[model samples]
Target chain A: MDRTEQERLITENRRKRELRYIATFVLMAVIFAVIVVLNINTGSVKISVPEIFRVIFLRQGDKVKYDIIWSIRLPRIAMAAILGGALSLSGFLLQTFFSNPITGPFILGISSGAKMCVALSLIYYIQRFGHSSSVIMILAAFVGALLSTGFVLLLSRKIRNMSILLVGGIMVSYICSAVTDFIVTFADDSNIVNLHGWSLGSFAGSTWTDFYTALAIIGVCAVVTFLAAKPISAFQLGENYAQSMGVNIRLFRVMLILLSSVLSATVTAYAGPISFVGIAVPHLVKRSLNTAKPIIVIPATFLGGAVFCMFCDLIARTAFSPTEMNISTVTSIFGAPVVIAMILKRNGGVKQ
Target chain B: MSEYVSASGLTVGYNGRPLIRDIALSIRRGEIVTLIGPNGSGKSTILKTLTRHLAAIGGTVTIDSEDLSGITYKELAKKMAVLLTDRTRPELMTCRDVVAMGRYPYTGSLGLLTEEDQKLISDAMVMVNVLELSDRDFQNLSDGQRQRVLLARAICQEPQVIVLDEPTSFLDIRYKIELFGILKKMAIERNTTVIMSLHEIDLAEKISDKILCVKGDHIEHFGTPEEIFSTGLIGTLYDISPKAFNPLLGSVEMPAPSGEPHTFVISACGSGIPVFRALQKAGKPFAAGILYENDVDWQVAFSLAAEVVTEKPFEEISDEAMRRARELIDACEEVILCPVPVGSVNARLRELINYARNAKPCREA
Candidate 1:
């Protein structure tokens, strides 16, 4: 090729790369806006889209509808975004940290531990306490998550391989789940009803208070993770490589686990431990985007996760209409196929 | 004078095995040092211990006379860059993004690259000749190109000391020479101390300012190539056979002693080279009766300079050719043969081997 032709080719390549970045950002923003709008409009009442917007932005609605729109639908949607973003971002961090495609937010057993705590609380006095039970449940979930993380850390110290630690986490999860099941079998009628709802997972009980509580936790975790994205990207190369680059690998692993646990447990306490969103959304983001770097993948996962949950919730509310299916069931319908395809694809083997 | 990196009485290991035991080594400024050894000889262990990837078990490794452990991770990053022979990771990253990571120590919260930093990165990519690949995905490159891209990333780190393990393992012969040339140039022109492990002995000898040969639990010898390349030392180091040198090749020949001879046919230009050397080493003698000039096999014959009866390309043989061939064949107890790709031009060679096989089977033939 001639010099001018070569230069033009180089310039054209650079322009295309720049356009891809811009296009991805624009698409994510458009999806985020659509998810927010769809989330606000869908609920038990068939409210008009413009009317819901007026309640949200213009303040023109009846007290009952306003209460339902502002207090119920808004918080539920906001919680979905917060928890979705949190779970998926946590999944991105875990995937990068483990350098494994199959690694998800719940792989470290913190989600299972949080689920166990919420199950324990639900099988005891959850209905008796009502709204106050949310606060107690969140604290218990946080403690459970921390305990699980501590156990994983201890087992990690014993094993040199990351895969071994992952197996240890899964084993701990099984043990905790067995104990929770045994506890549920012996509980009273009221406890069983509460446990069933929590286990199925829903944003049905979301309130403004719950949204703020989750937002505070998820927001702080997100900011910290955003700042940590570069180091986490370094981890994608491997722990030894990251350490050689002067990343404090020991401290970084602990920080990642702690932050991810807070995000997962907060969502569990507020929205009652949804499944599939954390494990499946990051893989979908990776498959679509074809990049594992946290700087790009983290934000993409956040927006992607929000859109995924919002769409799933839309399906859950509309498919059954008056009956109302659990959010997890709807998410799994979309999520399972992706999980299966990933397992079958080449180079899809996730690190332990 | 301050050494850029110095480890005094340093001991490092895992589970009390002491992989590197009480070793004292110092790297001065602007030198290309090479560590050469067999597998599991603790060459990598020593490098890791010095770089602070593995903590010293008993002694201190001081960079610029400061305790290495006391240096902050960011500060240590400014002092050194390391490239290891692990699989390259292809994240959602372009080659530029991967190289830009070297500037992470200098980047702020926004991770923005300044104009000067951009120039450094470009310069690094150019030095390693990966500037064209800057826009391509790192995973898409050939193994040689990928190694250079990674080297570009390390150069972008702009550290004083660069440590690499088997950097040329994936490279082709030309790229391997080019990489060593760049490394040698960096050591001299930029005053960077470069330490790397290499299996390419000839390349290492040509480029390295000093060589550290590790074998069997410790540093066997550490010196200049000329200081360490004596025949006795090399023979002992590699456990080579043949107590004395070969007068023909003027190099050590490690070959198995005599075994029963088997007639063989080799037609390759370079393929016959190994068999000829093997025959010489095992005390088996052979004679060549026919050859043509300007062929690859002819080059091997010329290098070994073996005696052979020759004719011009595509020329008909006379009574003299038949007489010489018969004399050489009669001297040998049996005939070993070879075929050259001389088409119908040398159809007589194929006929000769066929004739011998048909008439074969004498007592030690």
Candidate 2:
């Protein structure tokens, strides 16, 4: 009630908050380490942990084991982590940009649009030159993502309702998917199989080059988002308040769109489009951290996405021993429930 | 110093067309200015334009004598703050966090609160009596409490001028009074110019140094509340019937119970207010009388009573007045007497009360 008593209580609350945040970050780090170790160790044709470590650290092991780690398993694991982080961080940025918790690259059809463009480019390049480069795929995905984002942005300007905007996004997504289907149906047989695996969204047969490309794009975007924490915090109040707080709204908006698009595009180019992580991981990170301040949530969201996707990738690889489930299938199983819970939690607060 | 905030030839409206044009205003530092007008008269549009929430279709607003369009948003933010009617429901933010956001112009890249910023926030919460609410989620607060918390946020901004649009609309009496008090203190103590639109003309008359009357397609009047209220401008500005608002008492009443007089009320010194109300609600045409002009009862009585037999304030009861009061009492079918102190200056009511007590047609209620 009085000044002295209230200050003491706030101080205690701050102390408790500090401990809680520390515990959460430490827990996330621990989970991330555990999932990474388990992913590398528990794959098919298992190499023992000591042999895996010797192969990873000492650069010496059985030739087959070495090939699996260097050429197959290691790159696959790295792609999963890097692309997963990219997806969730993009989701976080979109959620902030729209000021809606449920918005993400996947739900907004950004990934689907990117997949369509990547498919088109792959078919054109492979049919003409007998080859397709990662650079071209990333560029095509980026262009497709911008197209979808542009549609959503124009639609959002006309409609303030999130559900209507989501419907528009889905419609745009459907058109792109239909066109991709037409391409797949007409493509020559060899490229058709490659398109099937990429469209279904997978982390298989990933190479070191794909891993490095995803790492560079995601890392830069994530850091920029973190640096924008102050404006993002103000933005949570609404756009007017964010502008009133000295944020250059026009520039800030363009940056958010560009960065989020690049991150999601990188994910799509590397792993097709993983579902739900873009919508779910940011929610989980903010929930665990108990704060949505971008300075903290952005990094935690990246780590959370890494841990979640790695775990899902493990199940996708080992669920049937050799018959791998699609990575999107695995993510939807775990991440869709979180999304459903978010919807229920939101609707539960409204009275009939 | 030049006026803290002023607009000249300002035209404000939606979608780039002017709703009210050629508006000019000048508010001094440490002054509280209020805008009062009829609904749909564009008071809010004017406030919005002044706050830069809506761009002015034409003309310019000068803040601290600087051309508004020339000022950067960051510089303007350091000099002014605005609170509009749009309810901002920021999820997962505590009241303190909402208030702390007022330090945006001063905070670093991460928006972390410095020690001095925290002190300003705490002091603002104390002023608004929301110290205990600091840790509570902002969305969970009741409307009145939420209003106070927002006032605290505006205070934390430490701007030279604060513009609020309809600041008292949803608040109860206590919150309204407290908010006005806080606004007044800020204007005087911090030398912050306060500009806001209020629906309460009565409160506006009491609180504002300058009142802007908006009506029709133009800025109607801008002057002291004395000049505005004494001219009985509010009723005309609002298109209200003459009897609906009593400018002298700063109160409102139903259109005087019209028709032939059927009941007489004997009262003076503010006691007849309830009796007049009851008679008005019952739809009984009443003639209420025998009072000094200065009595608080006269305003409502003058509004509701079919005929008010009156005497001048502080004047002795004349024979003519007593005769008029007795005649009205006799003509009435029923008499209602209000229990008022029998004073010497206007003891004429005693004769009327005795007559009612002896032969009152109503049940002496």
Candidate 3:
């Protein structure tokens, strides 16, 4: 009721709103610059920044620059951005779905599912079908991912405890790894070599087709998820509260898990298992946004993912030059330490 | 048509083990039905089964003749709200936010709160006297405040029946009285059936309209509290010996023999709450020296209050704690006891009793 206190309340409200918008704008600008500069400058053949922009927009570059810019670097950059965004967004979704901060897209064996399918395609199925394997590999990966997701969901219903559910997921991943290994043992030398490279995860092999494919899936799923944000926020409270809120808990849970798995599985099929970006980027985004409201965190996560993956790709290519390190190797070096720190900090904290 | 929620031939358990077998019971509208029994006596199991949280192995539960299984969850939400004992939630949501969750069943797919829903939530908060605390984080509230918030949340659901599991366990005396008052008002004004389980047998006896005495393996008795109380069913339920007497207010207390001298506790109502525990902890033997006819602590003195001599006018000590102390000296080889400040009427009980004892020849102070 006092004038000073009333003035203070208005000032505080305006400050928070302005701070949030400013943070969002800054992050978006940074991500755009990182994607453009990192992809253009760090590849095997570099082009000037102005040339890169012209080739991208006005199509006025020389033949070599055009080919490098259009044919190789752009698609690779796009692939890294899309896969990064997809993975982190999926990570955010999975964490909320399970009500446990430790959950990620790959935590439930989806990466292993895709890995097994890719290995099977490279070794046995591709040998028989010659050059017709990508389609088969995609289908196999989708099915494998679906199966793993179904298993996780079923076990979750029976088990009720999130810790046990996480353990079940890890067990399934281990089993899939074992089966993939068994298949690899009998494959020919060239097939083994090809499968091994694919398993390390790369943006080097991306083409325009891969970019468009990933973009479409990521776009559709992201839209669906954005629309489901309200229900997801309700879920953060608890299932009983969500159900009482007129949310069909079973249906929303299934949809969320399926979306996250599909996004991660598709990305994994194309990019191998890119480590930590999915698990770590969302946390980073949430920390920056200071609110886990999906409306804000979801977009922040997508942009954060893009910048993080692009930067990681730059590190992967430039660290040793002429000897490209696995993107996962770069990500793990940066991401795993942050994750370890979070786990240590969580020891004295309340768990979800 | 049954004016009650009834289970016929109900058998409930987990993994093929029936915890409660072939039971039949009904709870009528506007009645405060209490299920009193020891731990693992199937009290919570019955509440769970009634709420359909657990399915019965061999019976049908019907509310107003509609089979429980056939009813939709939203419809059931309207009919009854079941409160479990566990109170933890992951999110540090506000009390209002938690209470608004009760309106979920009525909300549409969008889950937006309607004006009416908001009103109901506020009304529930007011009823529980937590309106001012609505904006506070639910996790930050004291146990008693948190309890009322939960009850408010359930009330916001606006169910025809309310069932609580140990609702008073975390409450202080003041909050406990407030909660029971709210429950009573809900039953009287809204004609809603109220059922709860409690370890406080005497308090339950005072407030409950109907008492379901669960003992051994089945429903030992179900009737009006007066009928059950007169039968001394509560006495047998807890295994307190029949020597428990209440000189005032007909409350129960353990009485020592008239000639036996005992360091009778001169404590009053709330005073005796901790005396029993203290006596048990110290392993001391004491008895009621003298208790008044209507002294509220007489409940403490009458039941397990203490071993005592009955006196009239409640406040005027019949024979002082000193005379009773001397008698207690004769009965016990030694006495170790504490004093309770019941009220001004008999505040001298302790000093008088101390005066009655002389320094022991070999005992140190």
TM-score, every prediction: 0.82, 0.95, 0.77
Tell me the tens digit of each residue's lDDT in model 2 across B1-365. Answer: 56778899999999987899999999999999999999889988898888777888999999999988788888888888877777777767788888888898998878888889989999999999998898888878988788788778888989899988898977999888899899989987899999999988889988999999999688779999999988767778998887787777778788766788899987777788988898899998989888778888888888899998888888888889888877887788888767778778767667668877676575444
Best by lDDT: 2
Give residue A255's error in model 3 in angstroms: 4.0
Q: For candidate 1, lDDT tens digit of each residue in A212-323?
A: 8788878889888988887887776677767777788889988987887788888777766666677689887766665566776777788888888878877777787888
Pairs of residues clashing in candidate 2: none
Residue B91, model 2: lDDT of: 63
Interface CA RMSD of each prediction in angstroms: 2.8, 1.3, 5.2
Model 1 chain B worst lDDT window (10 residues):
B241-250
Instruction: Please give, for residues A209-254, the per-residue lDDT of candidate 2 as tens digits.
Output: 8788778888888888889888888888887777666777889999
Angstrom error at residue B91, model 3:
4.7
Sorted into a CAPRI-style docking class, model 2 comes out as medium
lDDT (tens digit, per residue) of candidate 1 on B1-365 = 35888777888776556776667778798888888777777778878877778777888888877899999887888888888888866655678777877876777764667878877887787788777776787766778887888788788888888999889888987888788888888888888999889876666667777888877566777887666664345455555533333322334433423433333322334555666565666566554446666444544444342355566766754457556655555555566554345467666766555555555532211
The best candidate by DockQ is 2
Output the lDDT of residue A76, model 1.
79
> What DockQ do you compute for every candidate structure?
0.28, 0.65, 0.19
Q: Could you tell me the fnat of model 3?
A: 0.18
Which of the predicted structures, 1 or 3, would earn the higher lDDT when compared with the native?
Answer: 3
For model 2 the local lDDT of residue B53 reads 72
Better of 2 and 3 by lDDT: 2
The weakest ten consecutive residues by lDDT in model 3 chain B span B356-365
Compare the candidates by TM-score and give the number of the best one.
Answer: 2
